[model samples]
Target: MNRAERPPATLTELLSRHDCDQALLAALRERRLPELHFYQSGPSVRAWTELCSSSAYRGYARSFALVDAHAQTIASALPDRPIEVVSLGAGDGAKDLRLLRALASTGRRPRYTAIDASYPLLAGACAAAIESGYPARGIRADLLRDAHCREAGRMLDRQRARLCLLLGGNIGAWDPGDTLRLLRRLTEDQDYLLIDAHQFSERDTLPQYDNPTNRRFALAPLRALGLDDSAGDVHFRLGTSATVPGLALVEKCFEFVETSTVSVGGARFAFRRGDSIRMSSSGKFQGHAFALFLESAGFRIRHQFGGQAGGQVLLLAQRRGAGG
Candidate 1:
């Protein structure tokens, strides 16, 4: 309650649980192995850098605006109480910093906490927050686990009111139904959520991924693992399933065709043509279905906004009261 001095030490420490390390390790291994191999060769950093710096990467800005508006709403809802802002997947804290700066103009000093899985990004956020004169702290935790949610709940329990943000279409990047339930479990009473939802669209989604710029972004991390575009064939595809009405699911899968043998950590590894790696992140609900998902999440929508891409939705919702 007295302002955390630093972010949680490790994913396990933050969650306050220990059983899932093996499962988590496996997931991370699957996700990072290619990147790690590419990093060994030193060309992947460029892709990762470009991916984070491009205009498309700044999508969180829209969410930040919605959050600022939501903050104003919360200020009106709890006229005399202090508000605490917690951001899940708070990448680099740039967007949140904008809101904090605006809050400062209003003469309201809010306590801020940013939780992220990336240490480098968390460090950047910490530095930015400090420079901006915010009493901010960062927590490194994986939100997919229950223990982390419980810890987050404990942190929010102390605030008079809390605003939790899950930005960058992070919800769509995973299973929305389960993710929403996990989000609800982490939220304490009196907390609000400002989340970005992808509007479902029938247009060609592959071009976005296939774009040279976007492809560079995707492969940068892979290149870091010593895998080049020529090293493997990258494939993109969509998953058609009806989880909710009006929502279309498209999944981008990257298959790296290894052309030669590589070594990592003093060990040798080999790859063949048929061997493929899959990196599937979902893009969902580009339009109307976006609204329905929020309603199903037990949130009473207060307002919504249209994004520049025409397929993204930003929603400001309040947790439904008991019996609502």
Candidate 2:
């Protein structure tokens, strides 16, 4: 259709003409920010960085360093061939560097790819790999989208074996079923999947998300919706899945103190005084439960590593019957 003779189009269609973010718009319509969206902008990235540095949340990252202790074992488990590392949700590329260094020590140079939805985070991940003198590149991808996942798979060098890294106990950040489907998409018959999960113990995890820095990060979406601190209260509580028995998650949400409504793009969305909207949640698998979960989801667990009194775990997995 000719531009002058076209029918009326919605703002989204117009925005599309200028390349606006479809995912952000879709989430904004719900007045909530899912975990992936939390890192898309610089402000959110800085907020996450602040939370990660705080005493409350910083300790969890130390657990990921366990990969260093298990690197040689991980290398020995893999096939004796060139391996390219693909890091999903590769924020800052810190953890992948540990794995890459392990591969490098095997008398071979390793290639790395950091895929993320955030340009700022993607740039940092790519830069870290380049600075370490390893060949690397960043692919801008929304991990939640199947098309994006398939596109990323296409970019890999097909001849070499692939070791997919989904570290930082990230398995908790997504729904268990969703996570399983995602892993299947990211791996192939000969590929390796390195994933980790933090156990949701009331003692260690509860206080971490309830602290000041994390509170700020959780309230950001509500604040953007034009709600002030006085408009509601923030709470961190543990939730469980009805279907999956061992599954548990710590949820961060904002409860409205009074009835309120918001207007965006001429759409009025209502909120009750007691209603709440989630900011984020991480699925915490207890002990060998994570390993069992992977097997149930059709992934074959090859090697397992952990520390912090069994509160954390890293599993090297592959598709069922994928072993050479």
Per lDDT, the best of the predicted structures is 2
Encode model 2's per-residue lDDT on 1-324: one tens digit a residue: 343443231110111211224554566567555777677556778887887677778545665566778888887788778888989888888878888888888854678888877777877887777777677888776666677677777778888888998887677777777776777777887578888778667678788777888888776645655667787888888888765667787877778888877544445567788877766577777656778888877778888776343367888898765343
Q: Cα lDDT of all candidates, in order?
A: 0.59, 0.72
**Model 1, CA-based lDDT:** 0.59
Clashes of each: 18, 2
lDDT of 1 by residue, 1-324 (tens): 223544332222362223233333354346433221221123443464565556654444445556555555544443245667688877667767766665555666666788865556666676677666677777766676677777766765364567677776777666666578668876654467777765554564545455666666566544544565687656667665567666555555555455555443344445666665555455666546676777777887766766434345677667786777
TM-score of 2: 0.85
Name the runs in model 2 displaced over 4 angstroms.
Answer: 1-21, 221-227, 258-272, 307-310, 322-324
Which pairs clash in model 2? 172-282, 172-283
